[model samples]
Target: MGQKRSTFLFSALCFGMAFLYIPMLLLIIYSFNYSKIVPVWGGWSLRWYKVLFESEEVWSALTLSLKIAVMNATFATLLGTLAGLALVRFGRFKGRTLFSGMITAPLVMPEVITGLSLLLLFITMAELIGWPGERGITTITIAHITFSMAYVAVIIQSRLAGMAQDLEEAAMDLGSKPIRVLVDITLPLLAPGMVAGWLLAFTLSLDDLVIASFVTGPGANTLPILIYSRIRLGLRPDINALATIIIVVVTIGVIIAGYLMLRQQKQRERDMQMAAQEVVKLDA
Candidate 1:
């Protein structure tokens, strides 16, 4: 009975995987199809892709989206790293808990509410200070950073909490000041966490749609906004092609990252073994 149940569970998991992937697979297959509606399997052609490239509007949107993603990720990572350091390493003060909560509030708040609130804030600021007179690329970047920073802060705070302070202490003992110790020890140790936070921020900024839609003005639509507009019009084969390209790019990146990580781990292990051998030879 247990074996039968296990087999049933395995089959169920396989079915679940298929259910999740089949739509994506069909979309990819139909991207090459010459038919308007998908899954009809007309003769394959690269016409849709050609049309996608020929459209200057799509390229403009894509370029703008990439620019936003890069800028937002850089700003968000810097802000989040500082916030995470203060939250995890700085002295606890009055409203420490409140500050932490406020920093992370964007994460839990619905996108609509967040966007609306940011829009209102921007309007008020513009009215008072005559800055950011209208919603556009700047507003979208601000909105994305608001949420992306929260995510980065959370990841970095966790990493900081797990990190040992011994290295910094040792550096201090060797005549380094606090800032110097941080630069030499803490930042080096936090390199992986920083990379992770930056990547997370970049992904969130790139994928944002709902908030971007609300905050974006007439002429500053990102790729996601453009894709959504197209989706509302109709499910085009070009979208499927775009999605497939994204999937392939992401897959390749992950594979390369994994390979590099494994290589680094092996290198570290080899160094440790060589050090141990040296110590053993000295003892003999």
Candidate 2:
């Protein structure tokens, strides 16, 4: 009876999962449907996909989104890693709590509030310095980086907290300069966390729509903004095709990330085993 109950529970969970994804799965399948009406089967064809690629505006928006995502992700990771290192290394120094709160403020703040505040700030800066005349690509990128950096900082801080400081101390004891120790030991150990942070920031920036909408100006529209405008008119097969492409890309990325994480785990296990063997040899 217990086995049967467990099996039933598992089946129910699987059904729930399917139920949640069925609409999305059907939408994707129907992207290739030749009929205008979506959510109903017409006939399968690749014409929509071809049409999507043929549109210069779609390609332009996609390229712009990629560029902004890359820039925001890189900046966020670099700055956030530095912030995390300081938080971990400095510990409970002067105003540590305040500093930490400031670092994570972006994470809890509402997106609309953040966007409005940033828009006002940009306007003030542009008036004072005459740089960014209006909200544009630069503003959008900055806004993305602001929120994305918080995520990176949180991830890096968690990883740094878990890491033992003894390795870094040992390097220093072995006559390595502080910079050398950080470069060779600390940075290497923190690499996985940093990479994870970068990936997270990249995904966030790429997926941002609300924040992007607030900060974007003429000729600076991202793919999400363009797609959203189209959807407001009516559901198009092109939009379905676009959604399907995005789903496929995201799915592949998740799979790749899972594979990389498993590989990293295996590598860490092997290293731990080798270290144990060396310790045993020394003891003998």
Candidate 3:
């Protein structure tokens, strides 16, 4: 029975992995096909890559997406961190429930609804304040920030919840002002969570399509939007090449992050061992 169960689990794992990765592998392989038609396999060549690199539209869209993602991530992280701190650190203030609900509402909201609401808000703002006369990078970035911050806030909240308050209380007891303790103790401990939140926010912003589509105006296409439009026209080799490039970039990022995390874990283990040794020596 145990052997059969193990075999079934192993087979399930393999099947799941293949289900998720086989499509990506095929896409990467097809990206090298020389033919313009995606379905037809021509001899392996870098023709599409060359074409992709030459396309000014692709480059412009990529540049704009990166800029928006960066701006959204930074602003989202800042705002989310503040909201998380308030929710967790500020003791039972009036309207705390309403505030927390508003911060997290985006998480459960439908993309279409969120996009429509943001579009309406932008139009209303334009009519009232006469700012953001046209919806483009600024409007898209704002839209991304609105939803991305919810994910960041959730991450920050979970991190803060798991963290012990002993260090912060001790800092405050040792003649440290509230601001000083927060800056010295709380923020330092929250650094990893903040970095994670920022990365998540960046990825969310970059991957956004619906919200960006609703908020963006003429000549302001994001990479996802461009790819989608191209796909609609028909699958092109250049789209495959673009996707392959994105896969490579994302793989490299994942590998680097894994290496850093493993190194940090090893360093933490070594510190714990050294502390144990010192304690034993003191006892002896």
Candidate 4:
């Protein structure tokens, strides 16, 4: 019975992995096809990659997306960190429940609804203030920031909840001002969470389609938007090539980040062991 169960579990894991990765593998393989028609397999060639690199539209969209993602991630992380600090450290301010609900409302909201609401808000703001006269990268970045910050705030809240307050309290007791304690102790401990939050926010902004579509205007296509429009026309080899490039870049980034994290963890473990040995020697 145990052998059968183990075999079943192993099979299930393999199936799940294949289900997720098979499509991507096919896409990467097809990207090299010499044929323009996606379904027809011509001899393997780098033709699409050359076409993709030379396309000014693709490069422009990619550059715009990167700029917006960077801006959105930075703003989201800053705002989210502030909101998380307030929620976790402020100790029951008035309207805390309402504030918390508002911050997290985007997480539960439908993308269509969020997009429509933001569109309306931007239109209204334009009518009243005459600012952002046209919806483009700025509007899209703002929309992305609005939703992305909620995810960052949740991450920060969870990180704060798990962290012990002893160090912060000790800093306070040692004549550190509240600002100093926060800057020196709390923020340092929250660094990992902040980095994770920023990355998450960046990914969210980059991957956004619906919100960006609603908020964007003429000549402001993001990479996803451009890909989506092209796919609607027909599947092109260049789209596959672009996707393969993205997948490769993302995979490389993940591998590098994992390696760095492992190294840091090992160093931390060594430091802990050395501290333990020194304490033992002193006691002896």
Candidate 5:
């Protein structure tokens, strides 16, 4: 009976994995097809990739997306770090609960509503100040930052929660000013969390479609918007090629990050062992 149950579970897991990943694998594989018709695969070739490279629209869209992602990541990390510090380090203040809810409102709210609201606000601002002449890269980046900051704040909050407060408290006790302690101790300890938050923000910005669609104006088509428009017309081989490229790039980044993290872990372990040995010598 146990063997039968195990077999059933294994089959279910395999089916689940296939269901999730098979379409992506097929997309990657079909990227190399010479045929323009998606289903009719005529021998493997990189024809579409070359064409995708030459297409100015794809390049423009990708450039806009990358720019927004980078800007959003940077600003989100800074603002989120401040917000996280306020949430975790600062004692309860007036409207603390309200502030926390406002910070996290983007996380739970529907993207359409978020987009519509921001659009309305932007329109109001433009009328009031005559700034942001048209919704484009700037508007999109701001929209991304609004939501991306929430993810960053969450990551930073979790990190701060798990982190040792001893270093911070000790710094304060040793005549270090609050700002100095924050800069030297807290920020350094929070480096990993900041990096993680930045990456998360970047990914969220890059992947966002609905919010960006509402915020962006003419000439600011993001990669997702471009791909979405094309997919609406019909599946293009170039789109498949683009997806495969993104997959390859992301896979490589993950591998490199993993390797660096492993190296850091090993170095920390060695340092801890050496410090322990030094303590033993002092005791002796």
Candidate 6:
């Protein structure tokens, strides 16, 4: 009976994984197909890849998306880290509940609503101040940052909340100023969380389509937008190639992040062990 149950669980796990990954596997395989039609295996060739490389529009959209993702990741990490610090470290402030709720509102809000709300805000600001001239990359980047930062904040907050505050307290007790303690100790400890948040923000910004579409103007189509526009006609081999490329890039990033996280965990364990030994020696 136990053996049967174990086999059942393993089968279920395999089935779940296959359900999620088989489509991606097929897409990757078909990316190399020489035919314009997808899933229909024509002899494997680099024809679509060659065309993808030559398409100036695709490259432009890709470039724009990369720029926005990079900017959003950096800014979101900064703002989100600060917000997380505020929530975690600053205890019992006035309007703390409201501030926390506002910061996290993006996470729960529908994408369409977030996009429309941002569009409205941008338009209002533009009319009132006569700045930002028109909507385009800047608007899209800002919109992405607005939502992506919330995710980053939640990640950082969870990290901070789970962490022990003894090190921080010790450093402060040693006559270190709060700012110095944060800069020297807190920030170093939060490095993993910050990197995770940045990567999460980057992925969110790159994956965003609805928000980007609402914020982008003429000649500012992101890669997702370009793909959306083209797919309205029909799926091209070039799109398959593009998707394959994205899958490869994302997989690489995930691998790198996992490696870094594992390395950090090992380092942290070593540090704690060393600290324990030092404390034991002091007591002796």
Candidate number with greatest lDDT: 4
Give the residue spans of candidate 6 off by over 4 A.
263-284
* Prediction 1 TM-score vs. true: 0.93
Candidates ranked by TM-score: 3, 4, 5, 1, 2, 6
Task: Give per-model TM-scores.
Answer: 0.93, 0.91, 0.97, 0.96, 0.94, 0.90
True lDDT of residue 85, candidate 4: 92
Query: How big is the positional error of residue 98 in model 3, measured in Å on the Cα after superposition?
Result: 1.5
lDDT of each: 0.89, 0.91, 0.95, 0.96, 0.95, 0.93
* C-alpha-based local distance difference test score of model 4: 0.96
lDDT of 1: 0.89
lDDT of 6 by residue, 1-284 (tens): 99999999999999999999999998888889998787677898999999999999999999999999999999999999999999998888999999999999999999999999998998899999986788898999999989999998899999999988989999999999999999989999999899989989998998999999998888999999999999999878899899999999889978997898899999999999999999999999
Q: Please report the TM-score between candidate 6 and the true structure.
A: 0.90
Model 3: per-residue Cα lDDT over 53-143, one tens digit each? 9999999999999999999999999999999999998889999999999999999999999999999999999999987899999999999
Off by over 4 Å in 2: 1-4, 267-284
Model 2, span 1-284: residue lDDT tens: 99999999999999999999998988888899988777667788988999999999999999999999999999999999989999998767898888899999999999999988888888888999996886778999999999999999999999999999999899999999989998999899999899889989998988888889888888888999999998999889988999999999989989997998899999999999999999999999
Clashes counted in candidate 2 amount to: 0
Clashing residue pairs, backbone N/CA/C < 3 A, model 4: none
Clashes of 3: 0
In candidate 1, what are the lDDT values of residues 35-131, reduced to their tens digit? Answer: 7776567798876788788888889998999899999999999999999998988879789999999999998999999989888888899999998
Residue pairs with clashing backbones, model 5: none
**Which candidate, 2 or 3, has the higher TM-score?**
3
Q: Candidate 6: minimum summed lDDT over ten consecutive residues — where?
A: 35-44
